[model samples]
Target: MTPRDGARISGHQYGAGGELCLEYRPDNWEPQFTGAMMIGSAYRLLSGESPSDGEVADVASAHRQTVAQEVRNTKLRLILNTTLLDILVEQPLLQAQPFTLDEHWFAKHWLAHPRRLGSPDAPPIWAAAPPLTEPRTREGFAIRLPDETNVPFEGSYAFLNTILTALNFAPALERMTASDAEMPLLLVHRGTARLYSLAQGTGSRAVYVYRTIVAPANEQRLSAEHGVLADQCVAIVGCGSVGSKIAATLTRAGVGTLVLVDGDLLLPGNLVRNELDWRAVGLNKPDALAARLDDINPSTKTIVRRLLLGGQESSASTDSALQQIGQCDLIIDATADAQIFNLCGSVACAERKPLIWAEVFAGGIGGMIARSRPDLDPPPYAARRQILRWCDDNGIPWTGGDGEQYSLQIDAEKPPLIADDADVSVIAAHAGRMAIDLLKGGATTFPNSAYAIGMAREWIFAAPFDTYPIDLVPEGQWGPDADENARDELGGLLREFFPKAEEAADEG
Candidate 1:
């Protein structure tokens, strides 16, 4: 329709004031919400560094900022949410606050840097947008509710118009008359709790609600059908390269609860491979990883054990750590430590909890994921044995004899060189999917208990490397049934860590 048809059209993607407005019928979303915050923050990625004393903040700044501009034409989108206030009908900004544009505050905070601006001071920075949280725009949401692709528009204008007036937003609506916008609008359907969206459209006053990420439609259907993910609990013993990504993968699959156990602190070197962010340096790996997971999927509950398995000297309570492992539905051994790996396998077997161990082969040559649960037809540790056997069968070099393998570590002392970050991520995805399937009771077909991915194996063999691919011999495999001598070698180091550990060993 033309502008003369009584509808004002604005910009194709953004608004007249650099705002990207969206509306969500909280009930219309896949993972529905009740309320959100529309407080504007700098549109940012990776939450970049803020402006220094006199320097200007980049378009994609991180966290909160305290500066307001009547005209932000240079760049930046103003965002808002229902987070601070729940009711759409009540807004403090609507109570009649005149524009207090202080030139000094604006100049100081505008392109703040040490050369000119001394330090931070108060600056009014508020704008309006729809309340959207934990947005994942790059990825589509897996689920959307109501299943109606076309929203009815027969009689929405009067109610929308009335609500805008009652909420004191009529002024903005009137201004919208002059420009076209691609805005997402959310509203309560028929005054009911259900949310409906007046999605993407080409009018100055239209509200379009879009999300960064949502649950996949198929997965949502499967969730309603079986919900195997919702009922299971997994324990990730490491938050390192393979482990952290595996944790994220399971979360994406709708796993309800995760127990993270790791005592190490995030190192700067870890940024290249692990999921830890720049903000997580020196923090406990499990705790940092847990926070990241919560930000991604609030529905997943994480319990962190920031104690080392060094046994008694570990910062975590020994009893509590063991109890956490004992209680989990499955144990994921991602630590790759002989001590941690053996310990997890032993405990999982003893407790009869399921176990999945995944590791990236030296370099990006390939990787392996081994699964074992109560469903195994063989004896204890069979799952572990099978995965190793599969690795050997596939020509995976687990022995150090194949020369120094590529590793994720930059340390010279650490051998088994490492794979590139991308290759490791590929393996993590393979392992995560297998883990989820095993949790689904293994009725579905899998490549075998021990799954391997050599997608880039040929590339590895092609590269002039220091190592050669060798079979994963029995000695290279660490499973529950391994000789007691191997267990004691590692267990001895941790025994002094916990009194109970020594006692249990003696008793056993």
Candidate 2:
């Protein structure tokens, strides 16, 4: 029947609740409107009547027989299709058909090697004698039987099956005996059939077939020698968009233990970038983030804290938070609060844990990522000082805002500052990569590094500033008093990092 007719009949049968339907057409491999053909044929065979027109009598019995025959034919086609797929998987030769010289050599070596076909301990398949050889007009040589004086075709079953299966032959495995002379002949006669079939089959339609099938094998092999072990504990200090993304990436990359800390509840504003949704609103950010992370990678150990750091509430003190930070191998500062960032950095340094501090500047126009590790010769404090100096030298401003406050300069001629959102994601991702690289021992070339990304300029500068180390002592050699001296040192550092812009004439 025509495709349209088949579709109409299928819809009618499905709507009527018929069983044994055929929902797809094998010709183009598209789904039919419904599986009416199978359903109608099954009904006709059983009831001795025409399912569509409801015709009756002597002719109906004949119709039932015809319907039964059609059913058997359809079943056979399905079985053949399935069988082809199975054969290809079972036989390596079939799976790797259309063999290159390298492939043929490897296969011959593997088949002849004194190893098991199914087990490492099993005996070789061709251990009886050395492989036989036969020359081809264009293809190449095929393995020959030692005892047989006569050579089989060059692209014989042994050679062609491997190529076809590897190329596109479904039911990857095919059974052939000495009696199937045609099987051996078909290989040389139709060398391009398998290749043509592959071009027409699933290979042509796949989005990333090579990556989907081949990349994993390569990744696994490389990972065996270079894969990072997920043994270290990672502490994430916030569960906002940046924090949640970091946590998810870590878990997916096989982090062993993850400690998530955030006091805020999930809100509608958070959904714009957070991993969670409306259902998570009012729930603790850490807990919600942790739950979603667990779903993504169950092997990761997730610990949740529902309290903000450096706040006046319970368990908010620096000492209490430092206790938790001590257990982690690395700490990430993703909170927008400056107090929390300072607190995390201090605790991490005291405990010798590496810290990653990330911030977005200029409403998102620019961002900075800083990495601080105790083992490095120059700690992150030096890098922080350099960044601060760079900001000052570049005349970058920092206007204070309440609750995760950042200073913004409305005029372009003003100092470059952390005043926008453009910097947040860039800094966060950069810091996350730096942290991973550090943990993997891949950052030996550069230590105490900071990367700044400018969105408007589309620029990325690594290690953009010279280091100026600053001590973290409560009382400094710079002054007799502790708190006041510390404030003065910081304020002076800020002013030095961001000098006032010189006056210029208006061109307009």
TM-score of each: 0.52, 0.47
lDDT of 2 at 312: 43
lDDT of 1: 0.52
For candidate 1, the per-residue lDDT at 144 reads 19
Please count the clashing residue pairs in each candidate, in the order shown. Answer: 60, 48
| Count of clashing pairs, candidate 1 | 60
Q: What TM-score does prediction 1 earn?
A: 0.52
lDDT of 2 at 301: 82
**lDDT of predicted model 2:** 0.48
lDDT digits (tens) for residues 172-233 of candidate 1:
35533433322223332221111212333333234322221111222333454237777778
**True-vs-predicted CA distance for residue 412, candidate 2, Å:** 26
- lDDT for 339 in candidate 2 is 60
Give a tens-digit lDDT track for model 2, residues 386-483.
56766676554454322232211124444433332333455556666776776676535444366555554322322323222222222112111222
